[model samples]
Target: MGQDAIAPPNGITHIVWDWNGTLLDDNHANLAALNQVCAEFGRAPVELEYWRAVFRRPLLACYEELFGRPLADEEWARLNQTYDRHYSSLLPSCRLADGALQVLTSWTGRGRTQSLLSMAAHRHLEPLITERGLTRHFTRVDGRRHDGAHDSKAEHLVQHLEAQGISPSTVALIGDIDDDARAAREAGAHAVLVATGLMSRARLEATGHPVADSAAEAVAMLGD
Candidate 1:
């Protein structure tokens, strides 16, 4: 049987969700924001496929890849500010992914505990979640502190699971990127990558985690 046929661990009492590309359908906004920055830098605009294929953590690395060279600290900072400004402006046009509500509702109905973890700043993340009316579905919403650094989620995952008193083995992380799977592994939790997010199926599959095409499919893999 294929890897997708493999069942999730038994007794999955909790789920950790990655908010950006996973729960929120902000991929287009992300791409547009990046393209806006590229325009300012006189760089070629990146297509969605290119964005999906090359996106990764340590945000600088992704920028470097796109620019074809290392960015000076000052340049990186400006690019970050530019992208954030454009993305925030585009937020009003963003929406939740298809079937995301159904999946969250079904999981909640089944008495499953769910929490949101994101690399976005806490100040920004909470407002967006609240504005979307998704606050009630999550037991906790953890976002990065306003340190102006795009760090990995591994450390956050460790702290989040520990604070919740949830065993890693009894939890799964549903996300869209390899960093998400890496964070889940670091926390000793199962990683389920949904293809309907920022990264492409090929990239997510390269992480050797089960890849689902949608939130509903991811829930099916996690099981009840």
Candidate 2:
């Protein structure tokens, strides 16, 4: 396995969902912003198919791959500043995909607990959630910050578990990338990989993790 493989433990009551690609369907916007940034520096931009394979990591790693060169710390910061400026303007055009809100609402209606665990910085994620009117659906929302690092979803997941006074055995991580599954496994939580984001079914299944077609299916799988 690429990472540790694990099964769900008993009493999985909470769900932590990945934000951008999984819940928000912002991959198209993200790819556009990244390519736009790359073009400014005369770097070849990544295609949709190619980006899916390596889009889960931190922004700097994704930028380095596009430019075919590692950026200095300051250079990376400048690029992020630029990207954030462009992306913020584009946020108004973004929205949740099919079945995303339904799944979330279903859980909320049933009084099931949920939270957001994402690699996106809190500034961006918070407004998006508010704009989409999803803030009321979740008990907690955990995200990266502008001044702090959350290079991986795994780091945020650990912090969320501690802050929520919950254990991995009582929670599940729902996301669209291998990193999501890997993070859940490492944290001893159940992972429900969804196909609605960047990764395909083949890639998710290859990791030996359970996969769902959409958020609705993921929610159904957790049913009574």
Candidate 3:
């Protein structure tokens, strides 16, 4: 007789979501914005697949990779300024990913709690979430304070849980990148990644976390 394959650890009482490519679906806008920035620097435009494959944090490294050289502090700042301006102008046309709203609503309806955590600047992030009328769904919404723009999510995730009086062990973090899994584990929570971000499924799977194709699928893996 053979035993069953073990199911992944997804049992949790709370869900924490990542913004940007996960829920916001701003991949097109982000690519176009970066391409425009590259144009100013006399670099060729990059295809989405190439961009996705190379994208990772500390945003500075991703910028350097796209430009094919090291960026001085001033050059990096200028590039980021241009990218942010174009991105903001294009953002009104973007929308959330498929099943993003349904998953958030479904999780809430089940009487469990959820919140949002993003590396976006807080001033910008708050208004955007408010404009979408999504504020009611989250127990708390956190975005970076701008002073730590290039840092990872682990530190912020720690603060988010502590502020909510939620224990990390009872949490499940859903995000679209490998960093999300690393950050979640570093902060002592379960991680489930969706392949909806810049990273491919194979790449996300390499993080050794359960991977899903969409937000609804990710939440479902966490079970009842």
Candidate 4:
């Protein structure tokens, strides 16, 4: 809502991408790290199938549900700290989804405006992007401020748009889940979803929302 209302220059640039499931194909990493944390804290680990279903706002909300109560500030920090450690160890095995790098490369070639807005903590997200050699493709990478509670990706997207002077008309939110689509709508930008994320093709299609099968397709749709 705080963003400028004008349309972007006629060329159609300035993209906002969702990282997990969208870019890095790291939802499995998240599930693995979180489950590892659960084990460390004497809680049951959630399966990836369930994680895909319950992952949502308030970063710690899903964990709280699994832990049966809210974690203390210290406990929350420990979980975050430990999760990063576990996730980092597993990063070598993480792979970029099909066409992700190519799409990012195509966008970068034009020197367009772009950024990464994700629910994953900034600490972990940065290194992952850097390691994958995808950091250079984006003009900016933003995540939660890490102030204990989970930061909503929607809020981050709105803030980033305001700070970057991006207009809603020119900016399209590219993501792969309902949350991503909802955040784009909330931020007054077009939501262009990719089916490659945690969401199923059927579910994505069922929404009757504008969607792409891959990042390349998203880039093409945005050009239209």
Q: lDDT tens digits, residues 101-204, model 1?
A: 99899899998889999989889999889988999999889898644334688888888888888889989999999889888887899888899777899878
Query: Which ranges in model 3 have alpha carbons more than 4 Å from their true place?
Result: 1-7
Model 1 misses residue 201 by how many Å? 0.5
TM-score per model over all chains: 0.93, 0.87, 0.93, 0.78
Q: Which candidate is the best by lDDT?
A: 3
TM-score of 3: 0.93
Residues 57-116 of candidate 4 have per-residue lDDT tens digits of 566776798788988989999998999898878878778877888888878787777888
lDDT of 2 by residue, 2-51 (tens): 44444433466889988877788776777788777887778887787787
Per-residue lDDT of candidate 3, residues 160-204 (tens digit): 999999999999889988788878988999898888878777778
Model 2 steric clash pairs: none
Q: Model 3 residue 219 lDDT? A: 84
Candidate 2 deviation (Cα RMSD): 2.5
Task: Give the clashing pairs for model 4.
Answer: none
**Every candidate's lDDT:** 0.85, 0.77, 0.86, 0.74
Q: How accurate is candidate 2 locally (lDDT)?
A: 0.77
